[model samples]
Target: MTAALTVSIVVPILNEADNLPKLFEHLHQLTAKPQQIIIVDGGSIDGSFTLAQSLMTEMITIQQSAIDWQVLASSAGRALQMNRGAALASGDVLLFLHADTKLPNQAMTEIALAITQAKWGRFDVHLDSNKLLLKLVGSMINLRSRLSGIATGDQAIFVRRRIFEQLGGYPNQALMEDVEISKRLKAIGKPACLTSKVITSARRWQQHGTWHTILLMWRLRFDYWRGVSPDSLKRHYYNT
Candidate 1:
């Protein structure tokens, strides 16, 4: 009999204290929890690291759910933190989750089934907003991902640990690590493209006008495809 695959969720956080509590709460409510959850702090100044440590300790000493929870510190970069967490993970599959994203019900079960057929995959994602334009944006993102086999960090991207390691993990870049990794993974096999949707925060669009942010992202993506350096793009993304 084949043994069931275990999953390790790696979350890279940066000054996300405001979201940690809800994120942990959502994890606790999962129908099929992951084998372990690794929270890698990326030089947070807002006590995010302390909060994550406290939450992890409380979950271990109180909830005692059969899930292994860990808190780690890493350099201040998503790709760096994620790669560090992946190095410490001990599961057949590794799922990278954003701090502000909540996985859908049975997400672990869905990934388990998807991994059997594909080396990696990602869940569809929707923004947590009632605006019709934002709703349309989510639909367009999902459709584009399915057609291009490319994924963004907002979508919960899961992959077999072996393949992830073999590919040298996420590229050590300032931006577009998710896109780069997806391209490499797609070369080997098409992603499962699960329809289960993860709900991601729409704060970016809310803070910056929806159409403005959308156009900026599109321009950045086009520039990236045109061989513009990620470091340059990162500066532009943050400055704009």
Candidate 2:
């Protein structure tokens, strides 16, 4: 087997204590180990920080083959937290992961090979919901991403460290930073558009009705593309 590439997985999290165990479990089971994993905690009120620390401690003591890891506390905001984590990353590639997402099998090796072809890329997404509507939503999400060369954070966006730096990192927006960054990356080169999928929580869609959430997302994207301010779109998104 080929050696694992040097990948720094950076996760921006908030109040994800319930999800950390599963997330870390998958991280520990990677066929190709990451160079390091950085958890950027966005001031979670839940015990997420403690849980992550405990998990890291346990991995250090029990695992013979373990990736280096660290937990950083940052102000609340996904874009801010992710940019901060990337600044501290040391690997050749920086992967921005959402806390509620799980990478598919061999995702690490896939990313390593992917960055060789493109400056950045994202895996397709699978929503962890059995609802037929959500399954279709997942398919559309992947198809839209593939057609547009844009990626979302839930898709586990990865990029060469130097290219990420060249783009000045993700735009410091209240929301839609991923879309903005993807646009900039696409200007330089098309994304790899890997076939592997990352399973992400469908909590938002479940909290709202599936169709309602889908419409809201479509509206948000249209507004964003039409030059709407992210701050305004963020208010509309969470309020809906």
- Best-matching candidate per lDDT: 1
lDDT of 2 by residue, 119-195 (tens): 88999999999989899999999999999999999999999999899989999999999999999999999999998
Q: Note the residue pairs that clash in candidate 2.
A: none
How many residue pairs clash in model 1? 0
Sliding window of 10 residues with minimal summed lDDT for model 1: 1-10
Candidate 2, residue 233: how far the Cα is off, in Å: 1.1
Instruction: Give the distance in Å from residue 209's predicted Cα in candidate 1 to where it truly belongs.
Output: 0.6
Candidate number achieving the greatest TM-score relative to the actual structure: 1
Lowest lDDT block of 10, candidate 2: 1-10
**Clash totals for all models, in order?**
0, 0
